[model samples]
Target: MRVLKQVLAVAAAGLVGSRAVAAVQDDPWLTLLLGTATAVAALLAYQWVVRRTERRDVTELARAGAGTRIVRGTLVGFAMFAAVIVTIALLGGYHVHGLGSVTGVVGLFGFMAAAAVTEELLFRGLLFRLVEERLGTWLSLLVTGVLFGLIHLANPDASVWGATAITIEAGFMLAACYAATRTLWVPIGLHFGWNFAAGGIFSVVVSGNGESKGLLDATMSGPTLLSGGDFGPEASLYTVLAGLALTVVFLGLAHRRGRIVPRRRPVDAPAADVTVS
Candidate 1:
């Protein structure tokens, strides 16, 4: 029955995803917000139905607080994003946008929020947790990262290399952040910052979804390999290397914190057959 419930949840999430893609065909930013709202609503409805029918709570699967956990997670995630941007800037081949106008700044924040919520709920919340439960930690991380990249395959300017880079780089890094923090806020904030800087400030295509201009426009001329082709910095091998390094660092921290431990379920003796001897 638990397995059936998990399957149902995944199916429902897929339905929401289909709607999100269709909506994105409109204005990318607006669609992002709309899709996110729709997904949350749909999931709420599904949860309500499941609870009513099965008399079970879903919280046990992916439990975390709504207050402090989110705040701390987001702050830590912000630092990670800052580090990435700094690393990119130091590496050259990229320029950041300067907010010259109020409108542009507002628009940038809007895009950031919408994209953060949408991607976090889908990727970090549903997909990651679902895979983790069935495949164990490491395998789930790998599979989810690939899924994240594959989802962008149909984006306007996405390519095979771009998708592969995203799968191993941005995808893995974000997954590690979530796993390390065990909170959705960290991944959401990381996603927002990366996109905000890469596409909004840098004026790059965000995974081929949309183009954004932040305070300053970042121009990347050089070779496509250095510039990440049409997909953005996330598609570059350099970004992949950086992301892998970060992953290793986080994995080390996780190990030190004893995050990697054998999962166990306490065996409870079959409830004494009340009616039987």
Candidate 2:
């Protein structure tokens, strides 16, 4: 009941918020406002539901050092994506034509912010956390990671390989990020940073979404393996490698910090009394 309630409440907020943002995409300012509101609504919904259901504070969103953590995570996320782009460029898979629209950047920031917050809350905050209690850290990561990837299949340009790449790069790494830090801020920042860099800075298609006119008039070429084809650089081998590296780092930290949870063994059912018939 707790899980269902929390999921439903937050999911509703996210759904409505995303729709509102989409409705106002033509107006950058309105999109930004609605996107910001959506993010806030999702957070508020999470807080309210958690309080009612678990009778505890949403400690994962504690305000202490939140800004610093978010900034740090954002920087790291941006740097990682930048590195991937640079690598692709060096390999002649990417090119820069000219500057893109500044307005696009603003709109993208808003859209990506809402997406990052809602998704992190839904996947890492609610699903992974609740499932972790029963299945433990490793199993929860696997389950949530796969679900995250599968959900993206609904995107316009989604494919099997694209979904697999997303599962490995984003799903596993983001969950591991939460497990390591025990907070949603880091993963949220990281998610936003990566996405913003992809669409807002590079003007590329994000997560198989349609074309984005961001800060740069950039184009991609070369092999699909290198350029990520229509699914974008997230499907590239570099992204998978980078994500795996981060996953290993975060999971190692979690293990060292004793945050990894072992699977709970189900209690044996009481043996029924067998009277000789």
- The best candidate by TM-score is 2
Q: What is candidate 2's lDDT per residue for 150-172, written digit by digit as tens?
A: 99999999989989999999999
lDDT of 1: 0.63
The sequence of per-residue lDDT tens digits that candidate 1 reaches over residues 39-116 is 455446445545665577755224456445545545654455456556556778566555443345455555455556
lDDT of 2 at 27: 89
Q: What is the C-alpha lDDT of each candidate?
A: 0.63, 0.94
RMSD of each: 6.8, 4.2
Error of 1 at 132 (Å): 2.1
Off by over 4 Å in 1: 1-92, 96-101, 261-277
Task: Kindly report which residue pairs in candidate 2 clash with one another.
Answer: none
